[model samples]
Target: MSASVGGAVYAALAYLAWGLFPLYFKQIAQVPALEVILHRTLWSMVFVMAVLLVLRRWAWLGEVLRQPRLLARFGLSALLLSCNWLVYVWAVQQGQVLDASLGYFINPLVNVALGYLVLKERPRRLQWLAVGLAAVGVLWLALQTGHIPWVALVLALSFGFYGLMRKMASLGALEGLALETLLLAPLAAVALGLMSWQGRGALAQGEPGTIAWLLFAGPLTAIPLLLFAAGARRIQMTTLGLLQYISPSLQFMLGVWLYHEPMSGSRLAGFAFIWAALAVYSLDGLWQSRLRG
Candidate 1:
């Protein structure tokens, strides 16, 4: 297959994996979110470190450290990423996987807005229309639910910022994630220690099987990320933007069909509007990219 096709397939697999992640995270329902976050952070670090060594990226670490500005930027990305992880884990454990899915659905729009604001890259008229439609959907959902889905908002915002920072830093996938995990490791270690000292350690009390599954958390986090990185390098940002929908689509299906999350009429209407917006945006992106070609 062509590189573009190959990249698209990898992206699809990565996102599909991410879409089903709620299923995995929910399995460890017995553990506290914080402890789960800690395991995720620690194990992810171990996995990325191995990848880094195999890729001979240990030298890159020294280079990244020597550049204070890059290190600071990566550190900020890590902070945003940590927030995203914590909130997502909390949302899944609290039975708000659907809401988390909404966050991912809304994330692309947020990225568009961020692109305009942060990158000063103006969207075309169709892109603007897409943004407006998404906004209407979000507002309508809030009105019908009588509550803002703040968890979703937090997820979108944190992830959007993380993406923006990573784009700016221009670090490779494994390299960047290694730095991010390293940046967060000390704090996670402290939190884990505190939990242990307080005798509230969530990891200590889980069944051996449960804990063993938790070990998968690291690979679970890193693998899709690594896939995304590889795919990102080969595809245009616009293509990546469109591919993001694949994950949320799966999550939405899982929520409504399998998990039986409530789907009110208003919720359906709101999602329809958002879908319309995404359709416009995707078409516009493809059309414009074609024109450029």
Candidate 2:
């Protein structure tokens, strides 16, 4: 019980940090989303290296380098993560945090589908119903708005795949993230250097505060993720699922209340359907968990 409580606290903190991510990204919105991703990649590598050094965790690198297959697998996961980051940062910068939030809200359903397809895990009946409802909501949004919610779709799909890849990875959360950032950092460094040399980089054009904020992206990115890893280890999946909503919920509120993104009734209604689907999914998962125990 104590462990569970501790996990809940860690998960809540992680979600709170994630929910507040828009506030951080918006501060650096002056930087192009791609550049933001690059800096994030580079700084994350630096931060994780520092962490590993402090923890005396260098042995894993030697073993990882001996496995070419592992490297290639992580390479794909890195690409997916970078794609997810790019779309999210772009959405936030483009004043579409609500759309980004919607993507995350839809992500669990995507995970359900992926599990059924890739892992042959049979979802409960309510899970299938939840997926159908989410699909209908997505379709309604696309039809009524006369534009598919691509922002949300990309975020959900990319992240769902990223999660799937991570689920198969042999490393722990911190180590997996460390490997990903390490693999991507060289390219990210080259790109940032080229951008700076071309006089278009954040370092070249931004104010002192902006440069600092950009640097802070490393720890900002890593910390909540570490908290999440810690929390997941100690809690029930049901508790973790409930906690995961906090981030997107915060993003949605920030978009609607703080940033004042236009929320038409049509969009609101679409969200309503997705929310209902989530309700059904969550309740079913919780009930199943209790029954199994």
Cα lDDT of candidate 1 equals: 0.82
lDDT scores of the candidates, listed in order:
0.82, 0.84
Across residues 125-173, which tens digit of lDDT does each residue of candidate 2 receive?
A: 8878887887888888889879888998998888777767766678887
Alpha-carbon deviation at 168 in model 1, angstroms: 1.7
TM-score of each: 0.90, 0.91
Query: lDDT tens string, model 1, 159-257?
Result: 877766666667787888888899888888788778767776665555788878878888899898778777766664446667888888888998888
The regions of model 1 sitting more than 4 angstroms off are 1-10, 197-199, 233-237, 286-293
- How far out, in Å, is residue 251 in model 2? 0.9
C-alpha RMSD by candidate, in order: 2.3, 2.5
